[model samples]
Target: MIITDTHTHLYSNEFDEDRNEMIQRAIDAGVSRFFIPAIDSAYTHSMYDLEKAYPNTIFLMMGLHPTHVKDNYLEELQHVETELSKRKFYAIGEIGIDLYWDKTHLPEQQDSFRKQIQLAKQYKLPIVIHCREAFDEIFEILEEEKSPDLFGIFHCFTGNYEQALQAISYNMKLGIGGVVTFKNGKIDQFLNQIDLKHIVLETDSPYLAPIPLRGKRNESSYILNVVDKLSEIYNLSNEEIASITTENSKVVFGI
Candidate 1:
């Protein structure tokens, strides 16, 4: 069975020591495809290096993360445009409003999110959103940018059923990650109500590790844990979860 990790920062410094080993572990665990999202210009080199090292397994996206939006955001968006002009990327993402860390940059974050959505439309590419404590704000921009061209995944989705339906209306698939494995992760309560076609698996590795490994650094190999939990929640087999979610990921990433 082939599992697709639709949103992983495999190129992040968190895996600097044994990145190859970590990737191999995921491969052994049936995770054969990884979609890497860009945070900013700073991570471009490492992301490129990762793609070079695993040409067959890793795909990359370019954009400024919502948390990275700052006073110099215009320059950063320019950098994103420059990078997009140079080569192809799977999507324009890991971008959206993140109010959990700091709300001071709300205006800039909203602007950046809208601009990146425009970029995604320009390139006919999908997006991977990183929303936290700002669903209302994110939805506002998505509402304005809503179109057949503006479509992607709501990465690490942890919202209520209403929000899930709203995101789906905007042509987004909910990205399910390690959180679902948590005993108290609320998404589990209603995830079964959402069809498998609208769901995709992810680890959000080096962060948000699932139960048993909760609070520990996560890796793509641990995606199996998420898949197992999903099986229990949906009352489906692991293979079925893997198959359906992988297909759902392909629809988003166009892989």
Candidate 2:
């Protein structure tokens, strides 16, 4: 069962003491590929270091996260452009409107999201979104920028069935993660309605740990927990769920 954690922050300081061991735990649990998303210029080196440490399994995305769209956003976006010009990246992401953090930067967040989507199209790369309490805001920009070239994952998707359909219409796959196991994580109620082709598994580690580990620090190894939950949601075996979702991730990340 080759599970793919399409969105994770393995480079995060959360695992500083046992990063390799933590990653190995995931590997042992059959979670192999990890797609790391960029937050801003600040974590660039750490991300690169992680790539070097796990060249065979780690893929990176470059972008300015919406929460980071502060006063220095223009400069940050410039950094994203510069990095893209220098080398290859799997996607431009973890970018989108995040009203949950602060509403003051809504305008800047929307602009950054649109500009980065253009960048993704320029490079013919996928995008990984990080939306929170801004579905309508994010959808507005996606609507204006909708095109064959505009496509990616709706990371940590926690919307209704209609919103799921709306995101799919825009060529996006819904990123499922720890939330699928929550008692109140509503996505599970209708997730079966969306085909496995439009679904990809993720851990979003150091955050959103599923089930028994809920509210605790999450790691890639816990992706098995997600797989376990997916099996129930999709009415398939764990290996089958892994196979389907991993293949779905390939469709999005082009891995």
Candidate 3:
């Protein structure tokens, strides 16, 4: 079975020590596709190098992450636009409102988010959102930018069924990750009610590790934990879960 980790930061310094081994481990575990999200202009070279090294495995997205939005965000957005204009990107993402860390930059975050969404529309690419503690703000912007062409994944979605439906209304696929495997994750309870088509698998690795390995650093290979949990929750076989979610990922990333 082939599993797709639609969102992962393989280029992060977190993987610097054994990046090759970790990637091999993921391959051994049947995760063949890795979609890398951009943090800002700073990580672009690393991300591109990774794609070059693993040409068949890695796909790249371009965007300035919400947390990265700062006083000089306009310059960062210019960098994002320049890169996008220079080459092709799988998507425009990991961009959205994030108020959890600091609310001081909320307005800049909102502006960056809207600008990136416009960039995605201009390029005809889907967006991969990174929302935290700002659902109302994010949804408000999405509502304003709502159009036939504006659609993407709600990355690391851990909201309620109502939120799930609302995200779907915006034409986004819910990106299920390590949180689904947590005992108190809550999403597992209503996941079965959501169609498999509306869901895609991800690990958000070196971050939200799944149970049996929760509280530890996560890797792409650990995506198996998420697949196993999803199988149980959806009452389907692991292979089925992998295949369906992989296909759903393809539909979103156009891979």
How well does each candidate superpose onto the true structure, as a TM-score? 0.99, 0.99, 0.99
lDDT of each: 0.93, 0.93, 0.94
Off by over 4 Å in 2: none
Candidate order by decreasing lDDT: 3, 1, 2
- State residue 50's C-alpha deviation in candidate 1, in Å: 0.5
The digit string of per-residue lDDT tens for model 3 on 1-255 reads 999999999987889999999999999999999999999889999999999999999999999999999999999999999999899899998899998889999999999999999999999999999999989998999999999999899999988999999999999999999999898999999999999999999999889999999998899999999999988988999999999999998888888
Candidate 3 CA-lDDT value: 0.94
Segments in model 1 whose C-alpha atoms lie over 4 Å from true places: none
User: What TM-score does structure 2 among the candidates reach?
Assistant: 0.99
**CA lDDT, candidate 1, residue 81:** 99
Query: Taking the tens digit of each residue's C-alpha lDDT, what string does model 2 give over 192-214?
Result: 99998999999999899999999
Between prediction 1 and prediction 3, the one with superior lDDT is: 3
> Best lDDT goes to which candidate?
3
